[model samples]
Target: MSYTYDYPRPAVSADVVVFDSSTDSILLIQRKKDPFAGSWALPGGFMEMDEAADATAIRELKEETGLVVAQVEQIGAYSAVDRDPRGRVVTVAFMAEASTSESIAAADDAADAKWFPVDDLPELAFDHSQIISDCFSKSDKG
Candidate 1:
């Protein structure tokens, strides 16, 4: 059987560098799915067709955190070979920061979602560690 090459590769997604200036901490969710089950990672998910990158970011963020996204800034795009264990996936990383003093719990595929100090990060799944680092570097001086 011949496969259809007309379709573009499926895309993956992730939100990074979420921080609370009050606590100087970054937000992350404990993944409840495979490829890094039980590991803490940035809030994100797969991208759906017809939705803009930022739209996906807002949707995922709200779904995972239960907090309406107040602001979003596009950080960068990462498409490393083998970045995703499932298949070739491109991720658009977005930075979201807003004031929300309330404690957050997980919603979707995340077992739990919480904030951690940026400098004192836990071992994250995938190349998420790198994504977070790049985000920090950009705002490090600002």
Candidate 2:
């Protein structure tokens, strides 16, 4: 069953911030596609029709970085009108912890995946820089 509407709707996506507490670093993936190709960004993608935001985050993480996370805490939702270049995309961001001992290999839409110190990260794609900053701010308070 399908329905069509005259009004437009924003696309939804999910992003994950995988922090390695032991090293004080976070996981980043080099995008393999345009709109930010070669730039570092969080592991994420558009949500599927059958899955929830959190599930999308976990799936994208595993597909792009080869790291599976069982649990994640919701950071928040980003709905800035100009957030995504492709269109009006609202992203739900999640945070998770992974052990440095776990190995990650770039796959799917990611050209490369690696860890970077939270304070010394490279220029990130989209609104990721802000998202990461927000995550840290929230964590610092708790």
Candidate 3:
């Protein structure tokens, strides 16, 4: 059941911000692909046809970082036109808390995975720096 659309549709993706409050750190992954290869970013990917945004966040988190988070709260949607270099892509961001003790390994499209202090993060890919900042700001307010 494929149908052609007259207008172009933007790709939708989901991203997760896993924060460890005790350590004041966040989990990040080094991308393996060319869009931002070797750069650190959140655990995320394009959404699948059948899964919801939250499900995409969880699945991508597990697939890329080998971390299974039980739940997450929505941060918000980011739809900046130039956010993604690949094309017009809008991302729904989610946040969760995880223990720094939890084991994680790089897999799938992630070259590496590790936790970094929120205040001392490496340069990030995409709009991830802004995403992380927004997450913290929201948390601070709420």
lDDT of 2: 0.95
Model 3, position 63, has a per-residue lDDT of 98
Model 3, 1-113: lDDT tens digits are 99998998999999999999888999999999989999999999999899999999999999999999988899999999999999999999999999889999999999999
| Per-residue alpha-carbon lDDT of candidate 2 for residues 14-112, written as tens digits (9 for 90 to 100) | 999999888899999999999999999999999999999999999999999999999999999999999989999999999999987899999999999
Candidate 2 backbone collisions, by pair: none
What would you estimate as the lDDT of candidate 3? 0.94
Error of 3 at 56 (Å): 0.2
State every prediction's TM-score relative to the real structure.
0.88, 0.95, 0.95
**Top candidate when judged by lDDT against the true structure:** 2
Q: What is the C-alpha lDDT of each candidate?
A: 0.81, 0.95, 0.94
Model 2 misplacement above 4 A = 1-3
Superposed by TM-score, candidate 1 places the C-alpha of residue 90 at a distance from the truth, in angstroms, of 0.7
Residue 130 lDDT in candidate 2: 89
Residue 26 displacement (Å), model 3: 0.2
Give the 10-residue window scoring lowest on summed lDDT in candidate 3: 133-142
Cα TM-score of candidate 2: 0.95
lDDT of 1 by residue, 1-142 (tens): 9877977766667565577877788888899989899999888888777787888888888888776776688889999988889888889898877554865779988899887876788999878898887887877523
Sorted by lDDT (best first), the order is 2, 3, 1
